[model samples]
Target: MVDPDDVQFIDEMPHTATGKIQKTALRDMFADYAFPA
Candidate 1:
């Protein structure tokens, strides 16, 4: 199982024009994301 602290929730997910997940965008958006203690 994945550690709870390693999880995150968001109101929306970044996507491409074609509706495919934009990994690059996600990375940039969460570039400063920090996991919980």
Candidate 2:
């Protein structure tokens, strides 16, 4: 599970070509995501 306080936010549920969670995209999208300290 991801923290809600992260800098970058994607509320949409990840999905792949076969309706699977696209972790690659999600990782890429939030690669630089940083939470306030």
| TM-score against native, each model | 0.63, 0.56
Residues 1-37, candidate 2: write the lDDT tens digits.
9756645546797897799998898888877866679
Q: Name model 1 segments beyond 4 Å from true.
A: 1-5
- Model 2 clash pairs are none
Cα error of candidate 2 at position 29, Å: 0.6
Identify the leading candidate in terms of lDDT. Answer: 1
Tell how far residue 35 is off in model 2, in angstroms: 1.7
**In model 2, where do residues sit more than 4 Å from their true spots?**
1-11
Q: What is candidate 1's TM-score against the reference?
A: 0.63
